[model samples]
Target chain A: MTGLMRRWLAHAIFALAAFATPLLLSGNRYFAFIAGITFFSVLWATGMNLLYGYTGLMPLMFGGIAGISAYVTIGLSANGWSFWLAMLVGSVAASLVGIVLGLPALRLRGFYFTLCSLVIQTVITLAFVYFVNLTNGDVGISHIPLPELPGGRQLAGTAYELVLATIAVIGVVVLTVIVESSFGRRLTAIREDDGLAETLGINVTRQKLAAFFVASLFASVGGALYAPYVGFISPRSFDVLLSLNIWVMVAFGGRGTIWGPVIGAVILAPVPFVLQDYYTIKDVVYGLLIIGVVVLLPGGIVGGVKRKGRADAPAAVAKQAAPVR
Target chain B: MSDTTLIILLSTITTGLMLGLIFSLVAVGVTIIYGSIWMPNAANGQFFLLAALFAWSTSVSWGLQPALAALLVIGSSVPLSYALEILLVRRFYDVPNRNISYFVLTLGITQILSGIFSITYGVWSDQFQLPPLVPGVTMLGPFPIANNRLAAMLIAAVLLAILFALLRFHRYGRALRAVFQNRDAAALRGVNVRGIYRMSFVLGNAVIFAGGVLFACAYSFDLTIAWTMAITAFAIMIIGGPGSVLGALVIGIVFGLTQAVASIFASPTIAAFAYLGAMLIILLFRPSGLFAR
Candidate 1:
């Protein structure tokens, strides 16, 4: 099957699973919420993968960028803008900030690049927390109006889930295109060797900045959508931990693979909900799992599977020889 | 200036010193690991938190003296930290693109430890009162000073002095330094690079563990405190060049002082932002840090 067909099948299955989740599982509202959240998180991590996995730039500013977008969307909506417009503005803001941040990062590399990202994360979070006049700080903005559909069809509960799923589908599709374009190949080449890429006529700086902007765009959109879905916003929600989670998603999934982060999100996002009652054990288990996966799988879940598949012999012969092997 | 304002400034500066000393202790751990093994060890903050948790449990449960408790925390933590070095960190030394994994691993360990602590300790935010170690208050004429602050300062000073002295005089310290300056050369000269790496990781975390004990003794602690404080320490480690012990100390103290001073005139939240703002400015101007060389 073609790549497009594979993606469509995956998207259809995902949507079916998402819709069927809340309906089939009684008293699993928490699980349903997480399932929906997984979709958004997948988008966020994929954004991270574009920069980190493809471009080899570790942008730890995902949470901060997301926070900026979330706050902007919520802040604008408070001034009477529609929800979708607010989200759009949030994405633009994140992109602009991405450009601003990317400018400085152009000269820096390795630890320095990481440090710059850290500084951005810190500054953005601080602005959100202390800019109380606008952001409402720790108290955070609430009662974010749900998007209005035709015929005055108001979104709540399952209805809101449907809406977010549609947006998430659009985001994944758009991102897929971006990932398959010449830009994506450039990013991967840049990651492999920036010096060599530059020698070969690639504009390394521009590519890095472009990757940063694109990643930030997705992160901001994810964050904005997250605000209304959760029905609240706080600095606490978008802390460094969330940033780390984005890293974890990319790492645990196959980093460069287009669908890796989404798969990771699907598996990992629901674990907390599944282990909700044992919250304390949850983090420890989560940490152990990440370490275990990295150490054992090396190339992550998809990477490991692909390796195994390649190593397998001819199917007809291998079937008979499997036990011996 | 008014006497009240003057006193406030003096006290805030003093508090900043105490906070800075604690931060320096933690930053040193990250720095030492980076210095000796060339790894960021982002979980430095988590180790500090763990040490605080352990310190609190030991002090409250065993009714041990604060000095003994600090020592006990350090003693037990050293082996555990070294074990972590062997089991997890050792594998990553040769791998090319595993720094993010290292970050993720440390962060994962941090969260897990935090979760375990919250569960076992029940997340009740408690201040460990070491009345004997940190008494009530002392008067320096008109300037009344809390004994707790005074004791923290004294302890920090003594510990820092000892650390510097050890780094200068000890065989292990010299070996570690040799490794830091050139790992291959040091290894060629029979430095036992692997052994040095193990020792550095332990010492690095020991400092962090000690810092945590000092932090717990100074004020209050909850499960989230270390994680909250780690970001500030990250700023310090970056502001100060990585692998520079003196840089860590100086930058941490400066950061602490700035935060304390900001807290007086501005809201506490604004003070936190000021640290981040300062970090951004530093990154813009000198990406290598205040003293990268």
Candidate 2:
């Protein structure tokens, strides 16, 4: 089969699974809730993959962006705005924050930019906690109302799962288009060599800003979705560890690809939920899986699989086998 | 200035300098590892925690003198660092994105170690004491200071001074400088590059281990403080210009001072916000230092 056909078939399988998941759980609201959260994880991690996997910019502050947007959406919803409208405002604000941070930050090179991202995480979380009147301090804004399901009904249980799963699937499709476009080529080129890409008149900095803006939009949207799904929102929910976990997911599933981060989130996001009864095992297994994936499969599942498919292309395989420092 | 304002300024500056010295001590540890290994060790925090744990265990749990616990951390952590380099870090040394890969590995290590420590030590514990080693007032001219702070600061300064001298004068120091200049060239010069990598990792960790002991004694900390210290140290190292020891010390002190001074005018959380903001400004605007490339 051609690459296009393979992708479509995969998406077909994914959509079917997503739609069937609520039914598969069979009235287990807890599992259903966990699945709903998983959908959001996939969304956020894939959004992160767009920047880190393809663009070579590692954002440790994506969680804070997500938190900020969630807070905005919640604060608006408390004042009685439509859930979708609140979400929209929240996402746009997140993207604006993205642009502000990226414009100054993208000027720095490599890990220096990464350190700045860490500071972003610190400063934003601090802002969340410090601005008590705005963010409700550490107590966090609560009772975020459920989103309307477009047909004038509030979503709950399987309805929530189905909506989130559908949206997540749609997000993956959009991301697929993005990664396969000319813009995607430019992203990879910049990742490989910023100087050479700039020499080719690609305007590397502007492209970076655009990518960061979109990435933040996706993350903040996930945050916007989160408040309603869980019916409460807190600053503690989005922290540095969450950002670190998203990076791990992207890396594990495979960077520079559409499905890797989704696959990563799908596989790993549910572990802790399922293992809720096993705290010790949960932490150990989580840490072990992370270490095992990096040490054992440096290219992640996507890169490993792609390397096999491109057996005839030695140089490409070598390059894909390990990203250069 | 009013007496209240003057006192606040003096106390904040004094506290900032002390905390900054401790931060500098930690950042210099990070700097040495980055310089020698060419990979940023995010797992450096784990070493800090381990050192603190060991120190705490030796003195508080085992009921040893604080001085012995201080020696114990240096002794234990050196081997631990060397072992980690061999088992976890060595394999990724030559790969593409080795630095990042190692960074991820260190993150993994942090989680694993955190898990183990949480299991063993139960999240937060009232660990050993080193400050009470000199429990009283120390007069520094007209300003009376905590004897704990004075003692810890003196030890930290001496240790840092010793490290500087080692790098400046020792044979290993020469070999390390050579490795930093060009890994391939130093290897070609029969400099035992692998040995340097192992030794630098150990030596870097050992100092932090000792510093961690001192820091734990000097300040009251919980388990999660390791993560904060690591980030603050990274901020220090980056502002100092990555591989520069002097830069690490200077920047670490600056950050500590920033945090201390900010706290005087606002609540600590707000002070933390201000400190992070200042670090962000410095990180973005003035990345290069007296010694950063």
Candidate 3:
């Protein structure tokens, strides 16, 4: 009955559904594959939420970071290393790169930082394509071998889906823990006003870099798993659009809320697959959705609902006090 | 110099001038909009592509002269930008942190435009080229340049000169610069801030459209040019200071020359890396840009 208990219960239910969906759709591999992909989206959106929601930085290079990990992981695995070890190294290396890329965020705020990140994303994609021998160029590496298990069995089918589900659930739990921690409070403070947070004794630069490292881990880990799961890896796979799509998920779900991005990922992830036949119109629909979220639902679905509940809040008070032009 | 070196040197110069002029045009367009409204138009590349595509359709498919088609495309951007300003852009002018919202909004526009292009133009042909506006080759020393490309380069240069003159001497230009310096202060000086916003949006987009049409005239293009040009234009804008037209011109030319010269020794992809590396360095050392005034 307590709020804490209720929150935990919600998470538990979410985990159960995540695990159950794969088993439920195991009879149809197509649907199960979609579920697995949705899990990746959930993990990605949650990572994005940490930076975008809590830290107020919308990194358009998120997918590029993921691609960095994916490429590194794939390259290392091809050279006679274990996939697990490769993934670990790839994630850390990508995270380090992410911190370097995020150095601009220390000085630039809001739109400038976003533009800088956009440039970084473009460079990352170009690197993926230019390094042909490593990434196999625009042709992309296909038939990527699946990760191996401890029992010498390949991780595939229902087991892979379960693992993905578990990862997604863990991602959500990790995000929730971070959100409730003192570090989360610092991030929130910085997001609200970095200058004010600095005046209040928050080390804005260090906190931001730490946040980048943690968030990049989320992106890179999912990316490392993504290559083998999809059985392919391409520069196109982790380009700006992917980053935008994940950002869209977070923004649409209600950034700054724990459950919002997960809900957004669940609803929006399978949309392209479901509308596969109408592929031409798919992007148009997404475009309209992005515009709609910006124009009509700036706070997003969850945030909009929360705002309505607090209709008499300070925002309204401030609006009332403004002089009529 | 040997014949091959002579050829490479001439080609680099010619290519650099043509590409540099076009890059300056587009970067100027982006800077005006960003300088005025603080809205970093992510879809500026899409706007550029739209102009190119429209020119291709009119000149090649509709049988209009290339010059006429270019004019039509540039003129058409006026109404298109007006509609967009009134419908979408005007709504965000007063919002705090409007730049981020505008960025996201234009990205939506980008998605729509790219998606539409993929279906319509993508199905038509993988590549598109407009017919030469003038037939013949212009010999400059040992290098034979296509008359059409030469003409495109001249027109781009003229446009840049005219743009510089307008911004430097014209009343509208002064007002625009005023708004760029301080929006609130500009308003205090009896300048209609909203009207200036609308004008700059339309003018900026019109310049971008001109860049696109001119690019089409100079070379054959595909849909992929949109993203490439977008990144290149942004790099120029960043290095040149967001609101400085002079900065855009200088940095744009430098970038174009760098790309042309680098491609001579290495792959074209390496040229991209070089400019991008330069932009990153500039961003790190001078976030305000090389020409911030």
Candidate 4:
């Protein structure tokens, strides 16, 4: 259909822009670095969108999962393993851990699930600090070596940014593919009502775990790349705040929409870097934005627009009519 | 027993008791708020830290006695809670799945408060210590406990007793219990649900403030204490059963004891892990918590 063609056209445009950004900004290393970080944020926000947006389960331990991958990858690479192989192993390991952490989602729903995830995140952070031998006791691992290329040259600067752009673009394309697939529909059904979905023969548990694994892959891959890109890996680097920031991006852009989170990432990812000198008010500004988004625009920029177009949507009417249980 | 062993034993007991009582007070505060209203305040830790920070400012900077400062902070929570209730909380009271909204709202509050703290208090000192309320050390067998810590423990115990008594015998306490048991039934019985909700919110926040102030009086603190205490209090609440005051009291003591005892053998970080591990297990096995009625 023309709609599908239009969607792909939009995707192609986004892909072009994503790949072009690092190349265009390569002349300025500072801007290129920011662009690289934005790509990581985009990947993270997109991953979060799968769970938070489509599945309605906000995993606050998302950053912790990413940290798990970063640490594992660094640990393996230090042991003389190839960086690419280490990254693959690390991403898989982190996703497996994420599945375990998400076991509570099998039982708890909504607020309870969020609370459980918060606890899990706290525990993961503590584990990182407790295992000083592994995480360097919060001093963090710095000066991470860059991945070596086939010609023995280190992937650094603009080349590194380009690689990140490729990964981010691939991540978006993968998300788009998944979102348009039957699995995405099943996840959406579960999000709306897991019990109903289960009654309708949608293996809710299997589908939920599958979603966790897939989403966590996104988080882990970004985290693995993040370590060498920034040359840092600290417990603080992937704490609950990181998770919350990504979640905020997903929410602010509009959860449940593919491009919405990408837009959010583009707008918000550069904020901390842009306001580096005025760091004191950065959190305050972010906090105010969160409050503003929650109060004035619950549906987010994209969702609000969509809802406005379909003001009499049955879901909205049903939500309003539903009594407090 | 050997002298060192006796010293260790006595120290652990004292530390456990002090920590236990304060933990109970805060956990009870969190439970009451969650119970009466479905609001799981993510800002509970921030409120706790706020009181401690205020107490520090008053006692240390403004030259007020620590006890007087504690009183002032606890009293001030009433107005603060009222303002918060009016501005934000009451709006979500009628909203279904309000707990999620409250969690996000409080998280925003947490972010703003932490940002404010980083600029204001964070610029001054990484660690904050309040002058002891009573200047002396009390010797119990081989262990020496600070008089200030002992006083804080005593105050916490008395407050806990008072809270329990109010919940057991007071008219508002009965109304609160009624609402907690069944909101519709309570409303049908002419219990003012909204009034009880408002009162519980203020009362719960005040208790958390008391805990924070007492914590400052007993030991030095830092900004990181907010998150640590927040997780600890939440763990206690979840393990004890949300909205169950008695459960909070009992589990809070157990947690405090576990931390105190564990720290003797392992690092504090390990002690935190042990509790968190236990919390996750409890969540997995019994999501409703041990003391859910």
Q: Which candidate leads in DockQ? A: 4
B14 Cα displacement, candidate 2 (Å):
4.3
Q: Candidate 4 recovers what fraction of true contacts?
A: 0.69
Candidate 4 chain A lowest-lDDT run of ten: A316-325
Instruction: Give me the runs in candidate 4 sitting further than 4 Å from their true place.
Output: A1-3, A312-325, B123-125
Backbone clash tally for model 4? Answer: 0
Runs in model 1 with CA error above 4 Å? A1-32, A157-159, A313-325, B1-6, B124-126, B134-136
- In model 1, what is the error at residue A320, expressed in angstroms? 26
Alpha carbon RMSD to native, model 1: 4.3
Model 3, residue B116: displacement in angstroms?
A: 0.8
Best first by lDDT, ranked: 3, 4, 2, 1
TM-score of each: 0.89, 0.91, 0.96, 0.95
Candidate 2 Cα errors over 4 Å, as ranges: A1-7, A149-152, A309-325, B1-14, B123-131, B139-144
- lDDT of candidates 1 onward, in order: 0.76, 0.80, 0.92, 0.91
Q: Write the per-residue lDDT of candidate 2 for residues B169-193, one digit (tens) a residue.
A: 9999989989988999999989998
**What lDDT does candidate 2 reach at residue A103?**
68
Candidate 4's displacement at residue B92, Å, is 1.0
What would the per-residue lDDT of candidate 3 be over residues B1-293, giving only the tens digit for each residue?
A: 88878988999999988889999999999999999998888898999999999999999889998888999999999999999988899999999999999999999999999999998887644789899978899888788999999999999999999999999999999999999998899999999999999999999999999999999999999998888888888889889998999999998898788778877778888888877887888887898899999
